[model samples]
Target: MSHPTAPPPYEDHNPLYPGPPRPGGYGQPSVLPGGYPAYPTYPQPGYGHPAGYPQPVPPVHPMPMNYGHDYSEEERAGSDSFGEWDNRKVRHTFIQKVYCIISVQLLITVAIIAIFTFVEPVSEYVRNNVAVYYVSYAVFLATYLILACCQGPRRRFPWNIILLTVFTLALGFMTGTISSMYETKAVIIAMIITAVVAIAVTIFCFQTKVDFTSCTGLFCVLGIVLMVTGIVTSIVLLFRYIYWLHMVYAALGAICFTLFLAYDTQVVLGNRKHTISPEDYITGALQIYTDIVYIFTFVLQLVGNRD
Candidate 1:
């Protein structure tokens, strides 16, 4: 028997829902009224995707990492502190060396002065031999020029020490001869005054914020003025030795050299606009020694009673 004829393919023939039939079948895609393709087909793995469909996202790549070594906080701090400590140590050592040399030089000079001032024979010999004083002065000038102008000789190992020794001896002899001309009591008083003034000036230079190094030009001008005054005074003295005029010259000299001592001390300290290099310990010692000695000489002249 003919099985009940298969129900005709179901169709919604309702009048209210009218449209063109699906091209493929009930379960397949169909074109729209605008003649465009039905829902876009998925692209193959290697092919371009149809527009408007969510595109297959490109495979994501992670960012590259930094592999360089980084310093830890402790290591960085240690390195910084080490550098500062090393610098301070070097500066301290330089200062110590300079001061030690100066101390030795001063001791030698003081001993010479004492022998010349207190000892009868030495004092007479130094005084009678005026040529020796001139010779010592010449030696002092030559050695000073070599040390100040020739870096090679100044920095040479044993040679620098030798030159400095010779220079110190020459200067000491000259200073002692000058001391011989002064009364013992006056020399002692002048020595005390020089010591006091030198110590005071050094303390002030280290403590004060005022930078004397910045006044290099002023120092030069003052130096020139002092030199001119000294020349005029020398000429006046040759014509007639006026006690007041000589005293005035000595006073001016003492003041000028006192300022120089302060300047040189600050330079050696290396905390100012003008600082001696750490490598130039010899130069630093030389400058400071000269300033101090000059201070003593000028003070002696200012206050000492001539024998």
Candidate 2:
């Protein structure tokens, strides 16, 4: 069979047939071979049906959806930068406030100890009233424990600040009484050492990438070990005379609590992924205070000149 030749293009100026009514409109492009439209139909009638054949749409570049609001360039840039700046400022303020609370608590605790250590009448009274000291210590510790473990909206607002202040004061009283039993020189030295170590650990937690928060399980185990060791050491000191044993116990306790200080600092900093919230400043201060107390206690034991 002979091959059929292609038909000539439909001309709009043809005198014979007037070119099929100008392919659906005047000034519109002619439909090309195989029913493809030749020109863009943007801003024209029959937009989707140009020249009776579907016009190849210029690929409508839809505006990126902005959660339904049409934000201008400056508005979008300002919003993004403002959001980042606000987050950074919030974190900075939170850290500063938390540290300020911690510093105040530390000062209160240290002042209590200094009062008891330096004041002759207060030291004598605490030394003489053994029963009262024990009672007050037990009461303060129980109060702190209950308040610390309790979690609710009460732990949120003004209640948290009030409770934490009370806890700090009570703990300071207990610590002052206990420190009074130690030699003044030992107490002062221990305080200095504890302060230095705390400062160093706080700096390390802030600067280092080591995520001490991940060792929660390890800390719990160490806490249990310390408790058992404390019980055994207390019993030994109570029933038997062992100076070296006391020293060893004190040294071990100091080591454990220093680690705890580092861990708690990391949690308080809230920089790591497993960090405590900035809102938990009360808890953070409590943790750091407890670590410092234990550190001081152990250091005092190691340095105290026992009669």
Candidate 3:
């Protein structure tokens, strides 16, 4: 058995770590009775420090600011507006082509009329061959109606152009023959009035919000009635002439064709629910031209009767 050695005296300090005496051994608070690792220590008022020490402050960091942002809503709105603008541009282009075609048809008709009216030989020849003229006019009218119904806007370009041109020339020649019967002064006055009426109606149709396309069914019924009325009036005028009845017929015809013009113009503009296809520019022009032709014919009749 080994006996325990006696501790050194208080005056004999440790040679390896020589220091002043501490209130606590090792100058730290111990967690266990025998010193191992020490527990965390804090400053105490009655200990080496009279007052507690201040705690260290943590550094503050600012929140990140996002300078650039996504503008998805604005971009979407701009895209929608651009799409609407493109639609309007396309609609306007279709309308322009229709009008251009109608203008060409009108010019051709006017040129034929001028030639027949001003040139004496053509007018005399047509007047002398009245029977042959009627037969030819009937054939032309039949051919025009057949081609319009059959071909329409379905055929390819050059064929469509050729058929429409032939039909227009035939119709114009007939119109020229009719105009040759009227006095030059009467024809001029009627043409001026027809042009003024056409301009006014076109402007009105363009600006008005009223939907004429919806009234197509009603117009068709009215057309049949007008045709019957015209036939009766023609038979009456042939057997027994009534000046007032002729005037009424002319006035009614003019009104009908004017409404037709407004309706066709709306269809061409594509502002209606039931609209002509954008590709059917030729059909649109043909409808408008027919309306104008009827209007002119009625106006001429009214003026010719007055004379």
- Every candidate's lDDT: 0.80, 0.75, 0.74
Could you give candidate 1's per-residue lDDT for residues 1-307 as a string of tens digits? 3432222244643333354543222322333444444443333232234332353354333433545756678867765434333477787898899999999999999999999999999998887889989999999999999999999999989989999999999999999999999999988888899889988998998799988889999888879988999999999999999999988888888888888888888887765677777778999899888888888888888888887
lDDT of 2 by residue, 146-230 (tens): 6578776326687777777777888788889888888888888888998898889888887899887788899899999989998
Clashing pairs in 1: none
Best by TM-score: 1
Per-residue lDDT over 65-128 for candidate 3, one digit per residue giving the tens place of the 0 to 100 score:
5457554776667644343334887888888888898899999999988987888898788777
Provide the lDDT at 95 for model 2: 73
TM-score preference between candidates 2 and 3, better one: 2
Off by over 4 Å in 3: 1-86, 132-136, 151-154, 305-307
* Candidate number with greatest lDDT: 1
Q: Quote the RMSD, in angstroms, for model 3.
A: 19.3
Q: What are the candidates' C-alpha RMSDs?
A: 16.9, 9.9, 19.3
Candidate 2, superposed: residue stretches over 4 Å from native: 1-86
